[model samples]
Target chain A: MYEERHHSEILEDVLQFIYPLIILFGLYIILTGISQPGGGFQGGAVLVAIFMCRYLVSPREMGRLDLIQKIDKLILVFILALASMLILLGFREVIPYFNGIYNMLIGILIGIKVASGLTVIFYTFAFIEGGKED
Target chain B: MMPVVEKIMYIALIIFAFMSVQTPKLRRAVVYLAVFSAGSAFVYVLLGAPDAALAEAVIGSTIATIIFLSALQKYKAFTVYYTNEMRHEYRQSNLFRRRNAVLERIENFCSGKDLEAHIMYTTESLQEVMKNHGWDIIVRRKNNKFSIYGMEQNYHIEEMKKYIDENFNDLRKLGYEIELHIGWSENE
Candidate 1:
């Protein structure tokens, strides 16, 4: 499978060039989500392309999934905590410019959560489960 | 009118949805699903829901497609390597023609079992192929004898053994010794 992945040199070269651009685009979608059509979910899904592209470039190398999984769970906890603080505890009353800051913070957190969560899911399906057959 | 474009998108969405479900090959189905997702995203945009469109486009077309493809890589694909030892070039050999007839039967059996038959013709010696390649079955032809090497744990090979026994009884009567070599062990 690794040998088969190296069949196209052009794909590897082009992916190297396009990878950073994909990250930039995903980040753009995530950050500008407050005033734009795209939000955390869309940006996170776009970010998944980065890992997919990496797999395309080198099928043998399994990414740091444990770290991503950790990030996923940790971000989920943070989102819940932040949401509880804003809504249940009424922290919005305590802070100035709370709405914009809360929205931005939540969007960023959700973006990271979605990105890491999807990355973990992708790796699990692509590598972990597939590896069991071999 | 805008309604015409919306109708076209709806029709495309329905067509792609049906194609994704109806396709025999899993990879093609993933592609169809991606197209369906993209079409639905367009429809969402037309319905003045750009937010839903963005989400749909990214999740359906990008993430889901990758996940489906990854899952499919481990799907049932039966790999068979065919090597002719008596002749270095297989195309001109009489055994090659004979092997093709048997191969067609194996392919039919594979399809019946919902397995994609991935057959490769190699020039390597049996020992070299056995030592190097990852294969489900290796069909080797040496003169009139045919040796099929498979793992003991492979249930598909067991079914194939039965299939060959039932179908190729005529070939055995013609002095063609079809030997099924199992118990190769998992550790090479």
Candidate 2:
């Protein structure tokens, strides 16, 4: 119970800037990842994890973000699908981005996946949190 | 397989993540997120990305976490107000700032009304805004073709736009650029 309360307040506040930063951060991790560490999965997961973090951070701020959530989610899905599908298309015979140059595309897909997955988790949690008086 | 240290860091991350998940309030979750990020940073360090690790620490532990707590305060979030003034500052600041900001926005709008434009700029010539909403009306030519007479608005550009639109239209029609533009904002 304390955990929930503590996190709820914290997550809510963090979302103000964290969400945008997370997306930016994910991009940073992915784009720079090839030459360095942090490939698709970790970077992408981190991106989406931001959403979950945001959701957990600010459940009550839902009213403010209601429209944003819906529209943003739709856009996110399209982006992720497009990115992954593009990569998949490139891999007609073999996995795309055999070279590291196109690896950024893969990183993007991973980031999108991470973003969407966690967004869903948070979205559901927010729904539940809103349903009851806490 | 990841390193033992990395594995341990991962475990810490998971534990923190779970803590955030189990924690109901937003503030606690934010703090947990910070902790989780710190743990992830450790894993990153273990994996040889000290830069990423440092970033995570700064972002996760300090900046992001503080903001998250602030949001909770905004939302009447879970509380640990150890002091009255601290509680008062947290509780009142948002409301006050928002209220003032709204009023300021409105006042900015009101002030932008150019209540004295007819008196200020005659049906004159072209001028330039030095900065945002800076009204550099060329009352008189200075040091050759150089212009003068300027006023910078500290208000939303939208309000300034309305002022320009309302007061300067005649000038605009007369081929006098109002030297003012309304920016994109809530007023739009």
Candidate 3:
């Protein structure tokens, strides 16, 4: 509900310039998370920060919420199904190479799930004061 | 089992929590809360929970602060306009009379009700002040009589009217007059 600040032409240009780099870094974090310090939660948070910055700069340009919600739910169900299947198949008995592949797949799913969840929360909070759902 | 660094961190955490609650401005409080969260996140990391630390840093410092600040933007403001005589500007002859006393009273009232008080000192005519901006209360002084214009939409003015009438009515017997006007709607 904060009043929109006076927009500067330079800031928008700067954000446009650096946005791709930030997305690339976030993707790198998520993809390398299984063997690195960053993981799905951290990478998803970084990705959500992009949406936050976008809203801060231009509030009226948000896209469809239904699409985001659908993607989020789909990823969540997929993660649950995959985890349960692994458990039922006795995850400990899985070969090392297959485990690595499963780990990467699950990490990707979790990253997508987290990104969508945070996007939903941010959008809900942003528009709760009576703006359009976009 | 506490090292010097962790001991200091605990102390900082407690101090930040206290200051966050004690700050007067909502925005300042939010900033303090963010700092508190940051300190706690560091403690979590030191305690061998990087996952908790990351979640705390992201949700606590960034997103929560933004949400609180956005909510604070909708906080209703109470603005008071004090019309001063040209001479009173330079002649601080009486510090506790008229304008200052009224401002202090309003300040107390606002603090009690957790409202922000914006006091404006201007020599503009009452009509000009009312015409230009939205004001909750405008105190116009004219020949020993103070005309207080209160907007109708502000419910606080009605309670203020009762308090002022009760407390300042005795001053009317001393030859100074106080008139309360509470029916002016905005844009009219």
lDDT of 3 by residue, B1-188 (tens): 55777989999999999998997767788999999999999998888887778778877898788778656655656789888554346344554454465567777788677777888778776778888966789987777877788877788988898878787756788788888888865564
TM-scores, one per candidate: 0.75, 0.34, 0.74
Which candidate order results from sorting by DockQ in descending order?
Answer: 1, 3, 2
Give the worst 10-residue stretch by lDDT in candidate 2 chain B. Answer: B77-86
* lDDT string, candidate 1, A56-133, tens digits: 777767878899989999999999999888778887788899999988888888988888888887777777774633
DockQ of each: 0.61, 0.03, 0.30
Which CAPRI level is candidate 2?
A: incorrect
lDDT of 2 by residue, B1-188 (tens): 56777777777888999999987445567878887887888887878877677557655675456545544434421111011111213344654555322123323434344221211222222322222222423233222221223334433344444544565444346544334322323332
Instruction: List the candidate numbers ranked by TM-score, top first.
Output: 1, 3, 2
In candidate 3, the residue pairs with backbone N, CA or C atoms under 3 Å apart (3 or more residues apart, or in different chains) clash, namely: none
C-alpha lDDT (0 to 100) for residue B158 of candidate 2: 46
Model 2 spans with C-alpha error above 4 angstroms: A1-22, A49-98, B1-40, B43-188
Q: Residue B165 error for model 3, in Å?
A: 3.9
C-alpha RMSD of each candidate structure in angstroms: 5.3, 21.3, 5.4
**Cα lDDT for residue A59, model 2?**
47
Give the TM-score comparing model 1 with the true structure, all chains together. 0.75
> Per-prediction fnat values?
0.84, 0.00, 0.20
Best by lDDT: 1
